[model samples]
Target: MSPAKAPAKPVRILLAKVGLDGHDRGVKVVARALRDAGYEVIYTGLRQTPEMVVDAALQEDAQVIGLSLHSGAHMTLFPAVVSELKKKNATDIIVFGGGIIPDDDVEELKKQGVAELFTPGTPLQDIVEWLRKRFPSS
Candidate 1:
């Protein structure tokens, strides 16, 4: 008889709060939800710089990088993280974010290569499904 195959590894997600934003409740909630949904989450606490976030993602070998920005600095911070990841040849790391971001800014960020932006009221299930669909196990 043929042997059974082992299960694939869980997806790793890196969640961070970049810049001067100290409010982390939202990120924490998302982190917990992702963990409960079976994703390995690495949350970098508040006041993290763009470089720091990208470095953590690289070190953790995360497949997704989710930023929770409530300080209205998504424009600068998101692009900075994307830029840093590009610099390190890590553009394959999916970049997404959520916060008090305006609609116009969301379009701009997407144009700049942000995979997606989840605003307030976005369901945790939605995020979970999205990740699962895109990064399904081998």
Candidate 2:
């Protein structure tokens, strides 16, 4: 008799900060939480452009691309990243955002394929749980 094998682990994720967003305390917290939740998180440093973020995600072979934007440039940045990913034919990557984003922009960001948006004071456990369901922890 043969034993059944376990399923492969879910895809890894990249947590990045795009643009000149100096405030990274929240991003750091979430990164630690995600790592503790069993995801291989690639944390890109601050002031990255959309192209750079996408490039890092691609190079890291990440499945989930999370952007932490506090610079209020998300209106130009998030969509640009998404569009660049599309241009690169990277369709399987899931994107999300977190930061000091307004309510209206959050909806628009979702419409543009951001899976979810998290503002300040969002619980790290909640974000981790969401990733667990969305990407599944090994």
Candidate 3:
């Protein structure tokens, strides 16, 4: 008889709020949506530092890192997370974010290694689909 194969593991995504951003309604909604779509999500509650976020990502063995920022600190915070990930030799982890970021800032953030940025009114399904497409094996 042939041996049974193990089940495929669900994609692991770490969602976080960096800096002093306390408004978490949007992040919470994204978390729920991702979970409902069959992805394993780890949400580090409000007010996470870049260091805390990268560390959590490492500890969680996450395939993707999603930062929810609304404090207009994306220029500083996003790069910090990317730099920390590089320092730890963890650049393979995809970093993405969403919030009140301006168009010019979004382009620059992407140049700095943020995979994608979602603004307000971006459909939740779009985010879910993007993640699935970006990290298909995740």
Candidate 4:
């Protein structure tokens, strides 16, 4: 008889809106989608700082962080989140984001340790599928 393998832990993701961006409808929708997809999601709500996002993720023991931004602060805020994660020695935590970011900035963010970027209008299924592949339970 084959030995049974232990069940994998549920993928936990922390979703946050950093900087002064107050719009949160999109992030809330995403949180619901991720939750439905079986990911344990933590929503940090609006106007969070990068430090706050990282602190929450650490406290929650999240494996990923999904940032939502609309204040044109991708250049500043996204990198700040990445930097804070590095400082916390939590570089294993995957980072990704979506918003009205420009193509050029998307590449820049990816180069700066963001695992992925989803611009507005990308399907939510795409995000869920990416996570499924990135962190398969099997």
TM-score of each: 0.92, 0.89, 0.93, 0.92
Off by more than 4 A, model 3: 1-7
Residue 68 displacement (Å), model 3: 0.5
Residue range with the least summed lDDT across 10 consecutive positions in model 4: 3-12
Summarize candidate 3's per-residue lDDT along 1-138 as a digit string, tens digits. Answer: 895443288888999999988989999999999988888899989899999999999999998999999998999999999999999999999999999999999999999999999999999999989987986764
For model 2, name the residue pairs that clash.
none
* CA displacement after TM-score superposition, residue 93 of candidate 3 (Å): 0.2
- Candidate 4 residue-wise lDDT, 1-138, digit = tens: 895543468888999999998999999999999887877888878899999999999999999999999999899999999999999999999999999999999998999999999999999999999999998771
Candidate numbers, best TM-score first, in rank order: 3, 4, 1, 2
* Native-referenced Cα lDDT, model 1: 0.91
Query: Sorted on lDDT, highest at the top, how do the candidates line up?
Result: 3, 4, 1, 2
Per-residue lDDT of 26-100 in model 2, one digit per residue for the tens?
A: 888888888776677788888889899889989999998989988789888999989999999996898889998
lDDT of 3: 0.92
lDDT of 2: 0.84
Candidate 2 regions off by >4 Å? 1-10
Who wins the lDDT comparison?
3
